[model samples]
Every structure is written in C-alpha cells, then in structure tokens.
Target: MVGLMSGILLAPSAATAQVSDGGTVRQLDQLSQCRAMTDDKERLACFDRASAAILASRAAGDLMVLDRKAVIARKQSRFGLAVPTSEMFGGGRADEVTDVRQLDSTIKTASAAKAYGRWNLELANGSVWQTVDALTFGPSKGDAITLKEAPLGGYRATIAGGRSILVKRIR
Candidate 1:
C-alpha cells in the first residue's frame, strides 16, 4: 500500500517534468529559427511557423499555448498583417462614413478624418491619428487614407466616439 501511494504521487510529477523538457526544446528550436532568419519579413514568418508548431505540441490542459499564440500574433502585427478587433477601438462605438478629401488628386494626398470626439481620425496602420477641431469635413465610408506615398493598399477603419479609431491596413 505504501509503495502504490508513492507511485501515484510520483507519476504526475514525472509527467510534468517530461512536458517541461519538451516545451524547453520547442522554445529553443523556435529561437534558433528566429536567429537564422535574415530579414524582417522572413523573421516574422518564422515566428508564425514556430508559434503554430509550439501551440500544436502543447498538452490539452496547458496554458502556455496561449502565450505562444500571443507572441506569434504580435509578430504578424509587426508585418502589418494583423486584423484589428473591436476591443482595439478603446471601448467606443464604431461607425462607417463616406467622402474624404484628398490634399492632392494623385490619391497620394487622400486623407480620412475619423470623427472620434472633436473629429479624430486614424491611419490604416492603427498607428497614426489626425485630429480636427471644427468637425468641419470628416471621413466618410469608402474613403481611403494615405498612409505612405504611393498606394500600398486600403485600410478598414473603426471610428469610435470621435475620440479613438482603430485602422487595420488591408494588405
């Protein structure tokens, strides 16, 4: 009876130790791949691949999978491929509007002024903002904002209460 009780107590600990070793190996492999990558694009891709692999290898009840997923998600965002969620809008209601004016007709000067409190606008990368004081000419639906010179792509805008906007660049 004493031997059986000791075995039961030790079994879980051994399994846990095995899992820890596996996780460490996986993480080391991922780090090696990241170090081997040459460019920003390739590095991000590597992170994505490694993260997926690690997540798949995680045990059913392990919470570490969530951390791995988050790391990959952040890497994807650095590549400008992330899709913004509603929660990114800073806890405000989002609306779609139309008819933005271009500073120039070449489409390079186009600007979308998102009216989040007092006319606040956001750029496609969700990294920039434009604020207007008068609310006198704001962004409308189907309007595109120029994030950089020349057309990279279009962005979807989530305007919130004229205070904050979340823009996800559509690549």
Candidate 2:
C-alpha cells in the first residue's frame, strides 16, 4: 500500500495539479510534497509525516469518513423526517436520486394522538409518524405500511393495502 501511494505521490505534475485545483485534501497535499524529495529515505519520511498529520486530524475529530452503505443506512433510518434531499445526498443538486424516497416497515405499535381519532404510529424500524389526514382508518399493530413521498414534498402513508393518507414524522 505504501509503495503504491509513494508511486502515485511521486508523479509531481499530477500531484501539483490536484493540489492547485483544490481537489485534493490537505493530507494529500502534504503527501504530494513528498514527491519533491530526491532521496528514498527523505520521501518515506515525508510520507510518514503526512500520514501522522492525517491521523492527528482524525483523532481531533476534524475528519470523518463513511462508506456508501453506512450513509444509505442512515438515510433510510431518517426517512419520513423533514430532512432535505440535498442535505441527505451530500448537498448535491435537487435532481439527484439515490433511491431513498420511501420506507416499508411493519407497525411496532399504534396509539391515538391528542387529536380526536388521529393516530401516532411507531414502526418496527423505530420511526414515529402521525396521521395528518382525517382519521377514517387507523393502522393496527403489526400492519405493513409503506410511507411514500407525496406530491408537494409531503408524505403519504398506506397501511396494508388500504387507502393512502397524508402523514408526517413526529419523531
């Protein structure tokens, strides 16, 4: 791993271009400087120094790295909430889609809200949602539910093949 990194770092023009373009992180900029060293020992020392800096930054909580799966799991767990799509997808443009528009889970529990006939639903995944539409039907415990994105950036929930109703996440 170190040998491959050193080879890539030794490409001075490319490394310089990446740094100047502001595409490379600060740690990479440090490692790229190692390419300027002519002696192998000096270059290795520079790489070590760069690695130590990266570790220090991470230890200080200035840097965090997450894989796609972990991020997607977080997005799924946060579904039904009012989080903007741009924020959820790493601040990308509004048109980007990573397939996190809906959530399917069985009802873990259900109870009446303060409003007459309004229901508060707790899904198996631990998200809490409340019915916003008129209470014509109430979801029962263990009922399969699909919470989908409705028109105008709202949520519509359907329980066990019943009619869809407007809903919002309360927690």
Candidate 3:
C-alpha cells in the first residue's frame, strides 16, 4: 500500500501529460511547459512569464486566437478571392471538414462591362464577380444568385434560375 501510494504520487497528471504533445503555437507551448514543472513556485513563475509573453505577442500582432466559427466565417467571406489555399482556411481532411463550394446571395447591382457584353455583378455579401462568358440574359438588382466552384477552374454564377455563366472574382 505504501509503494502504491508512492507510485501514484510520482505519476504524471493530465496537465503534465498534455505538455509532451507538440504544439504549433509558441505562446501556447510556453504555457504548456509550465504544466511540466514539478516545483510549485517554479510552475507559478513559468505561468506568469508565459502569460506576459502571450500579451506581448498579441499586442505585436504575432499571435491571434480565433474560435472555429470565426475561422469558418472568414473562409466563407474569402470564397472566390484569389487567396492561396491552406489548412488555415478550411483546407484539411475531407472527411472532417469540407471547403466552401458555393455562396448564395442576392445581387446588389449588375452592369455591362465595356468589353464583350460581359457583366460585372455585385452580390449582397460585398463580393464582386465578373462574368467570363458573354451573357444572354443579365442579372438585375435584388435577384438571387448562387456562385459555385467550377469543376474545371474558376467559378460559375447562376443568376435567378437562369443558366450558369463562367465568372471570376474581381474584388
């Protein structure tokens, strides 16, 4: 019973166990290191130092903390932009998380460009999409539109139950 008690006392706690798992964030890693310290005073000191470092990083714009919802919202907002793809913006395991495939919105405005009868359409979500293909029927203000990822390349915009036209985000 005495040996059992000794073994239990020496065993790593849950907090300390997590410290061994590698973390990608430096400020978070610093805080995790505090859990591994055995000495009470040393652990407390480490925590204080880590907290200060986190504050400094945040103020310097070197570190940011975002909830999953905020990250997903950001990804949706940037859907048709020319931004590079990454795990940071919904690029991950397909089974776990799928990328944004389409955006449904109302047309804020639509105008014909000077060249080739192509149309420039502004959506309610503040995304400006320009048609790559010449339009037979142009979209109008307040018309519901759906912008989807084209299987080949670029994007396709379906305007108010009309046919899909190849489009690209201009803004």
Each prediction's TM-score versus the true structure: 0.22, 0.64, 0.62
Give lDDT tens digits, candidate 3, residues 1-171: 112211001112333332333434455667888989999999999999988876666565555445455555666788888884435432335213535778899999999987777989988888888999998777789999988899998899888888888999999
lDDT of each: 0.37, 0.72, 0.70
Higher-scoring candidate on TM-score, 1 or 2? 2
Best by lDDT: 2
Whole-model lDDT, model 1: 0.37
List candidate 2 stretches off by more than 4 Å. 1-24, 29-46, 83-85, 88-90, 93-99
Question: What's model 3's TM-score?
Answer: 0.62
Better of 1 and 3 by lDDT: 3
lDDT of 3 at 118: 93
Better of 1 and 2 by lDDT: 2
RMSD to the hidden true structure, all candidates: 18.0, 7.6, 11.1
Residue 46 C-alpha lDDT in model 2: 97
**Candidate 1 local lDDT, residue 87:** 31
